[model samples]
Target: MSVKPESASELFSGPFALGTFSAASGPAFPGLIDREGQVLDLRTALSDPALTMRGLLERWSAVLPQLRELASSSEPVRRPLEELRVLAPVEPRQIFQSGANYRQHVIDLHVAHRAPDDDRPEEERRAEAAEIMDRRAAEDLPYVFIGLPSSVTGPYDDVTLPAWAAKPDWELELVAVIGRPAHQVSVEEALEYVAGYTIANDLTDRATVFRRDMPQIGTDWLRSKNAPGFTPLGPWIVPAESIGDTGDLQLTLKLNGEVMQDESTKDMIFDVARMVAYASQTARLLPGDLVLTGSPAGNGMHWGRLLRDGDVMDASITGLGAQRTRCLAEES
Candidate 1:
């Protein structure tokens, strides 16, 4: 299928295609994807034998200009997107996830799980939660947690439902891929360090999110979120320049073809720049580091429906790309 390239003015910033491609000639290796949904062997394009996607990110300041020219230059030897295997854009060195960033999503969660002993009107509870969120955004810092890089998997890969996770859930997030080394950056300049944006389904085990014995320590992200294939990421990394308003994009997810999560990034209590800036205050973000800007509600936990074997998730973020993942049970 021939995909017409977006117009020159409509092109994604640097709009470089970065992913692993597999063809009949050999196994999968990292390459550049073009506007027409085709792959460009990076070695042939950059004329550098050591330029992998991660390498490109590490040198993004130098490579972006070249990519901009390459994207518009005469068509090079290309391979159809469907004919090759698409892997994760890059194996990120660090993964940071923002929690409770979506105002409405968090409010809905609190309202839904109100204490049974306290009899309060839903309307009053919702209003109170909204006030708290607004206060948090104004005065409190965002809640961020670390995730294991090993949990990463391809966008098209199957997600293994861990045997211990009885209530596997999905959280479709907008991932900001860092292109520059950032330490103590301001919100105004945070986007400058971002290479691109991609899709991430932050799969969680709802049953393990909290600990009765260790409530003081708070959520146990390691066990609740970081299992092999727990983070299914990428079909493409759309350059940040190509994206217009970071907070206005639509994020959607379907379970078995039914819309389970459909919301706009505008609902976030803290926007992308804030999330990046906040994460940077604690850690030096290097190229290829991923900061997931939380999901916009409609999670499985809210719907009273959790993932099961044979379930398929179709996740997409406006302009970034879409991903389809099938669920399978983990063998003991």
Candidate 2:
């Protein structure tokens, strides 16, 4: 099925999606799309002339309602979704990722890699981690790390495995795209900064996570996770208003058609509001910035399997859409 624009008068009859895509001719552009996969040219329809996902995010407060209204009307330039190449929803200026935020995921890892000397049942260890998670949720701040924007790639692009990486892993997450500037915002008002939500596959090089030489400094996320195309993001961004109960959405990932990571956002030790607010306290969050709200349990680390050449990943979240990434080893 392919989209061919018939007339400007035939806009989508109802609700639609939005994101960045490369049309028949041009660089990466942003536009609105319907469930039927019809694209509404945002530049032509909104009379912006120059609009990207980044631009829409920058003027989200003013553009959202306008987009909604235009989508409902019948006088917008239209095209089929098949006419374009989808890119990452937004090229983020700052990428913030939450770590160890899913209680069961952390517990599962601990149970799988138990120490030889410490003899304890899985149940006891799980309970201990659960207790710590609950207290940490209520008391401690989220553990966040900065990611490189260059690591991001289109949802359907190829994931290049670095020659130096022995173990590549996937962490599927719900990514929030920031709309407005935020600095030291309270948790109550943090959600207001989000323009929309998208899916992100936070690909990591597991073998590089720790440094034997510099154990005190801990994980070197930059070397482990910032390879080109490491972050596969979005088929599209669903407006925040359309998403109901962010905490309850299911996050799932499949490697070569096998369900590996499947869990609900409810398992998050720290929710989106807290994650965003905590991030703002340290640095100013600008439009198009991304915040990945941690992955749920069942990653490759817990399953004892890492990604290899030719492995395909299909990851999805409720309503936000899915992404498929094919992995290939770097050529010599």
Candidate 3:
């Protein structure tokens, strides 16, 4: 299904958003998407015809005004959005993913995936999980992990479920795109470093999440999450200024017309600012880098319903565009 501007405008509040689009056989170019469903080719509009989305983000502060003016004007060079193929918004040099950061998501997971040998009451397990979450939120740091840029794909691209992946799952998350260089920044200043926001479906192979052979090593995120096209990111990037409140945005994911996950950013144990700040304490955040806030409750695992071949996932975040990904099983 094609993305309609009228439908997109309901969720995306921005006057315009940055996206990467390409003709049938042409190379991708940076473009500005207006609310009226028109795309202004930034290649010809900007001074540099070769400017990429990442390059635009590097000069985001300086170029923002120009983009805003262009979006408001009747730019003759604009084309119908549906005429072009939308690609991932930006090619990030780094990707930082937060794990188990949502309050109810963790609580639900603890209850749903309880040890087979532990015959405890549901209420007792829930209370214990809630206490653990509360204490972690108060004391421990956010669990952040590295993800490969190679795993990134276009919002509407097909995801190949590897043959070895017995159980694949979907994790819809809100991604913060960095504009400025941030090193050891405080939580209060972290938002200032964020240029915009986008959506990402962090697909995972549940079977590889744990290392049964080496239990001491804990979770094996690399094997579970970093497959090619595992991360379907962006229909577009909404400027941070346009997104009023990051804390209250709703995140919803539908699997094959069924609402599998529906929750709000308010359920996050650590907000975007805290997660970004926590990431910067160890590594420098550069332009176009992505910091994915953890997924909320109602994942496939929680429902005991995992992804199958030919499944379609529609993920959306408030003020950020939506992404529709189709799943295909790998050939033997």
Displacement of residue 144 (Cα, Å) in model 1 is 1.1
What are the per-residue Cα lDDT tens digits for candidate 2 across 108-202? 86676565686988799888878878888778679999999999998888888989989899999999889999999999999999988889999
Clashes of 1: 2
RMSD of 2: 4.2
RMSD of 3: 1.9
Candidate 3 segments exceeding 4 Å error: 1-11
Candidate 1's C-alpha runs over 4 A off are: 1-16, 24-27, 113-119
Counted clashes in each candidate structure: 2, 1, 0
- Clashing residue pairs for model 3: none
Could you estimate the TM-score for every candidate? 0.92, 0.92, 0.96
Scored against the true structure, residue 242 in model 2 reaches a CA lDDT of 83
Give the lDDT of residue 319 in candidate 1. Answer: 82
Model 2 ranges off by over 4 Å: 1-14, 112-124
Tens digit per residue, CA lDDT, model 3, 10-121: 2467789989999998999999998887888898898787899999999989999998899889965788886888889999999999999999988987897777798999
**Least well predicted 10-residue stretch by lDDT in candidate 3:** 2-11
In candidate 2 the C-alpha lDDT for residue 203 amounts to 90
Clashing pairs in 2: 3-80
